[model samples]
Each structure stands twice: as structure tokens, then as C-alpha cells.
Target: MARNIAFGRIQEDMNKTSFFKILADEDLSSESMRLIPNEFWRSSECKILPPKVTLKVAWGSSWPVNLSPFMGCYLMERKGWEEFLNDNHLGDNEFLTFTNEGNNCITVDIFQKNCVEILKPLNTSSSNVKNEEMSCVDPVIAESNKRKVDSNVYGASSSSSSAATFSLTIKKSHLTLLSIPVTFAKEHMPKVRTKFVIHDPKGKPWEVVYVPSNGSKLFSSGWRFLANGYGLAVGDLCTFRLVRPKEMVLEVLHDSP
Candidate 1:
């Protein structure tokens, strides 16, 4: 399926408005989130508001979030939501307030228990990468790292002939989790949340959790281990070939095509 991913062109800006989101399990697990519908932008007709907006935080970092039209509202698409969630280590019950501080920037203030704002980034990534990689990484192409490749590298084309395969251009924002394309999810992914094995290019199996909700799928809950083990970084093009119903082979190319 040709996914129409032209997010609000990714350049849309927001009108002056404010909204809040209380993180829920489904929202956390899925690839997108819906902003509460309000008077300003209740639909695409409300183009005066941004379909895509920049998310700014207290710490001064900014991320671009794509908002897709949904039932009378906009959905915070997966493009930037994953990185935002992972970078912030957002958990259930957390409260997030998005205030449009002019210039199409949506300022994010994250809060937790009793509505106290969280100010620091929660560091949960493993520090010992070599040890972690050695535990579950397959013997990959040792020489691929030394070369500077382009950004379009792929193990398989998005126009893949096989229903069991897909390719992704990864970035730093997606290291903690990866969203399975909706078309792929609906056809190949398990409907119920399940555990699956993602084997590195060299055949080392990394067990990760599959979360499915609202017709979306994501590899979460242990994905970081796989990313760390594979040594996948921003700009790395990775191909996922499903060799078995519950398993896949992950091929990583450090450079672009």
C-alpha cells in the first residue's frame, strides 16, 4: 500500500490555543495520539490551526509533531510522537499541557503524580552497550560501520514484493521504539499484544514486545535492547524481513542508499 504520509506537509503551524493530554496506556502504546477537540481546530476545515506543529519543551529542545485529521480532531501522528515519548520517558497517568506559545510552537509541560511538572530527562538507556550487544546481537557486517553511506539505504524497498517485509529510515528519535506502518500492521501484525523475536542481521534473536491498539502496532517494551545491540543510529536504514509469523530478521545499513 502506498501510505499517504504527507503530514500537514510537516510545515504547518498552530494558531494560538492550548490543550492537555493525560497519558493513557493505549496512547502510550499506539503510534499516534488525538488532541482533545476544541472550538478552534475541530477539523481539517480549521486550517487556521496547524496540522503540523513544533513541540517545544522547558529544556529548550524542540520536536516536530504531525497532526492528522481524525474524528473532528487531530491525531498526534507517529512521526515525532515516539521520540517525544521515549525522550521524556512518559508513563501512564502523566499529564502533558501543550500551549501554543506563538510562532507555531507548542510548548510542552509534562506533569506527573498530583500534577507536579517533571523537569529532567529520565535516563533509562543502558550505559554498557558492548556488553548488551554481545548478549543478543548477531554477528553483523563488522566493516559496514567504517563507511559513510547515504540516507536511503535499505534491505528491501518499501514497494516490497513480500508482505512479510518492510524498511525504515531510523533516527535518534526512534531508538526506544518503532511504529509498524499501519498498512503492515493491519495485514501482518498480531491483533492482540504479543511477544516477538527480532533477529539481527547476523541471526541473533532479540525478544521484544508487540503492542497493538486502535489498529496500530509498535515494537516497544524491549526495543531499546534490540536497537542498542544492533548499534542502530540516526540515518541508519533498517529492513525488517519476517521469516516466521512471530519472528523477523533486522538488517541494518549504516549509510544511505
Candidate 2:
């Protein structure tokens, strides 16, 4: 087995912006890539073949200084290739770490503008893309309906209809299989850890949840299976209504002391 190797370099040519351009324009192959720590590749004891495309790997910020064009494509694909991103790969200023466990560990610390690409092995045959749907109840309509029913007991004239009052058109392309956001209002923050509710003009509602970031801001935009089954039309209106903050109903065991 070839021993793992580590390398780093400051390449003015290898920044994030430029890397993507190279990835899109270049057709990389295993033979064209350089195996670093020169001695590791020269070792006759370990028969580690060069990485194949579609390898599953984790990339932090650092690694063998420069990544091959094939490695760059691996990152783009592994990371969902979505440009709608918010940097979330690093836990802190720590250098990006890439590891191919049982094979080799590659670490690098490029300038912030450039990122190191790590190669990971994966089975592509099993990872098929499927069309799923998303469905969730709308918060605004749920609350409004509850209030109207409550007011009826007091003989108050509840003129408000069950149908929603205000709704904005949402594009189908904006929603994913996980009910995630493709594009959303930058100003609106979904009440901390909660989903975004969409109330329709008819007072119907839908919900889209957020997947917590795992050292990476990039997320697979997906919606619930149930919701997607119900066809969504472009230009259809939806509303987001604020709900009361979720609170613990029971006291913690430690609180009694």
C-alpha cells in the first residue's frame, strides 16, 4: 500500500473563481494528475492506482497544494454543484482537510481564495437521481383557522375566510425534492430552525424545511415526497406567516434543583 502524503503550495493560479472556470473548460484524466510527495508515488510496495472520476471525497481548505482538473470536478459534483452557497466547509480558520481513509490523507492550506480538492471513492451505480415531492402544512392558515373557530364561540363576526389573504407566486424550479430553497428572500430568516410556510390565496399552506449545515453551507435542495406529489404550478401564490416561538412545555429535570 502506498503511504499517505501531504503537500501545500501558494498558487496564484489556483483560486476558487478560477478553479471553477478550469473545471468547466478542462477534461481531466488520471494520467494527467500529479501524485505529490514524490516518494509516495515512486514507492514499489504499495500499488495505489490513481483516483478515478466519481470518487467520493471530503475537501477542507488544505491539501496537496494544487488539485488536478479531475479533482476539481469531483468537488463540484460532490458538493452538489449549486452556486447558491454560503461558505460552511470549515469549522473555523482550520486548514481544509481531505482524507481517503485506508488509502491516503491529503492536507493543504491554500489562500482563502483557493480551496484544496480531496478525492473520495464512491459507487455511482447505486446513487441514482429520483424525483420526489414535498408537502407541509402552512403556519399562517393553520393559525388563522384556529382563531376564527375560537371567535365563533364568543359570537364575534368572523368575516375572515379560511382562504388566505395574501400570497406570493413561487416558481416550481425554486423548490427541491427536500422542500429546500433554491432562491429565497435574503431578508427573511425562518424562525430559527423552523421551516418556511407558504400560504396560498385560497388559505391553503405549504412548508419547506432547512437542512442544518454540516461544516458546509451547500445543501441539496429537496422537498417532502407528499408535497411534490401534489402538482405545483408556476406563478401560484403562497404566503409565509410568523408563528409563536416554540418553547419547552416541561421543565428540565435539573431545573428542579
Candidate 3:
């Protein structure tokens, strides 16, 4: 009699996003660091990225980080990385957190010893100012001045908010069913299957079923027909915005020079 060997199925974790903390090596601190492999870029968990993604590194504000392919791997260039390290006064053994911020951007938070939080005042008092002059100022004028100061402090713009925008890159496997972020699905999707109306870049409306994740609830589904109708391919970037729970707007960004 011959014995048979059985292999167990490989299970994938769908809830986890690409996250890592790296110590400041000579190259990473002074030069560039290699990005995760192509498989990671193409993985269902990482479909929210483009082949040539724009990484906006943010500490207090955001700055564009250069990325290019070298030796079969992407490299976060030295120019911006060096400036970021030097500006933050990072040294050896300092820990840096790299997290995806959606829309092809990443946030880099620096952690070092002896860090302290300091609150800075937005405005300073002027001793030369007279109480009589302040008292005479109109209430409406004072409110307008405060609004201007607040806008300047927070960098507020007149443009629409981008909070509702969602980005994803197409994969070969996505043609069957698109994988959605676990947290997003839990908060936005219905418990049972539902229909969603999505508008494409050309403003064409599409109706598709939205199926919430089952079991561990790692991912959500229902985009096969939409992906096929749009002729999405691997490496193509798609952006979506939820106009309502059952309605959404979509935009496809083509690769440019």
C-alpha cells in the first residue's frame, strides 16, 4: 500500500495593510530604501496603488517622495528621504513608521528618544495695542479677522474635500471580484448583499451588487462587471467616491509620461 501526502491550503490575511517599522540604516538614513517586491504591489491587499504611485510623505505637512525602479525593485529616492531625515534630526536606531494613506500617498512618522510635545500659539499679543481701539472694533469685523487667521493656520482651501475619495489599482484577479478594505466595508457596506450605483469617469452609471465580507470579514466584493465594462487592467489606477451609501463616482487615471 502507498501512502498519500496532503497539503493544507494557504490562507491569506485580508485585513492587514502594508505596514513596517525600519531602523535608520546607513542607506535608508542617508540614501534610499528599496520598496516592497512587485508581488506586494500586485497583491489583492495592496490593489489600492498604482505601478508608478506618488508617495506623499507627511510629518506635519506633505512632501512628494520620488520613487523609481532599480534592479527589479522600487527605490524611495535619497533626495527627499535625506531632507526628511535631516529636517527631523533623526539618528541611528531611530524608528520610522511607514503607512499607506490611500490615494497613493504614504505617511512617515518619526519616533526618537526624548521627544516632547510643545503647543505653539497661533498669535501673539501686542503691548502697544490700546484697549480703546480694540473695544471700538465691530463684532462682524472681528469675526471675519478670526476666520481669516484660522484659515491661514490650517491651510484651508476653497476646493472640495477629498475625504470621500477611495483609490485602487486594478489586478488580473480583480476582474472577478474587487477586494475592498475591511474597515471601509464594515462602516459603509450593508450586512447583507445590496445593489450600488456607480458612475464612471465618463459619468456613465453602473449598477452592481455589493456583498459584505463573510466569516472573518476580511474583504468585500461585487465589482467584476464594473471592472470588465471599464476595461480595467493590471496597473491601472481607479479612484472612487461614495456620493451616497448606494451611489458612487469613479475615475480612472491613465499612466502619463
At residue 139, candidate 1 shows an lDDT of 21
Query: By the lDDT metric, which is better: model 2 or model 3?
Result: 3
lDDT of 2 by residue, 1-257 (tens): 00111121112112211111122122232232222223222322337433421211221111222233343332222232221011223222223322232222222222122332222112223223221111111343234323332222111232245422223454554344333232332222332344433322222333344444423221133244323544544554433332211100110011111
1-257 per-residue lDDT for model 3 (tens digits): 00000000011123223444455566663334545444445433454344433332211233445776766766666665554455444455554445443445553434343321111121224232111212222332222222212211111221135334557787776667776667666655556666666766333556666666474331234476677778777888877665433456677765453
Q: For residue 226, give model 1's deviation from the true position in Å.
A: 0.6
Give the better candidate number (1 or 2) by TM-score.
Answer: 1
Candidate 2 residues lying further than 4 Å off, grouped into runs, are 1-166, 177-208, 211-222, 246-257
In the predicted model 3, the residue pairs found to clash are: none
Q: After superposition, how far is residue 65 of candidate 1 from its true place, in Å?
A: 57
Model 1 lDDT, full chain set: 0.58
**Per-model lDDT:** 0.58, 0.27, 0.46
Better of 1 and 2 by lDDT: 1
TM-score ranking, high to low: 1, 3, 2
Best by TM-score: 1
What tens-digit string does per-residue lDDT give for candidate 1 at 1-257? Answer: 00111111111234445566678767574633545455534323334767676765533445667777767666678757876777767776787766554444555767675654453345536331111111111122111222222222222331234336688899776798898888877766767777776766443567788999885588999899889988888899887866444556788888754
Q: Which stretches of candidate 3 lie over 4 Å from their true place?
A: 1-159, 215-222
Model 3, position 75: C-alpha lDDT score: 64
| Highest lDDT against the true fold, candidate | 1
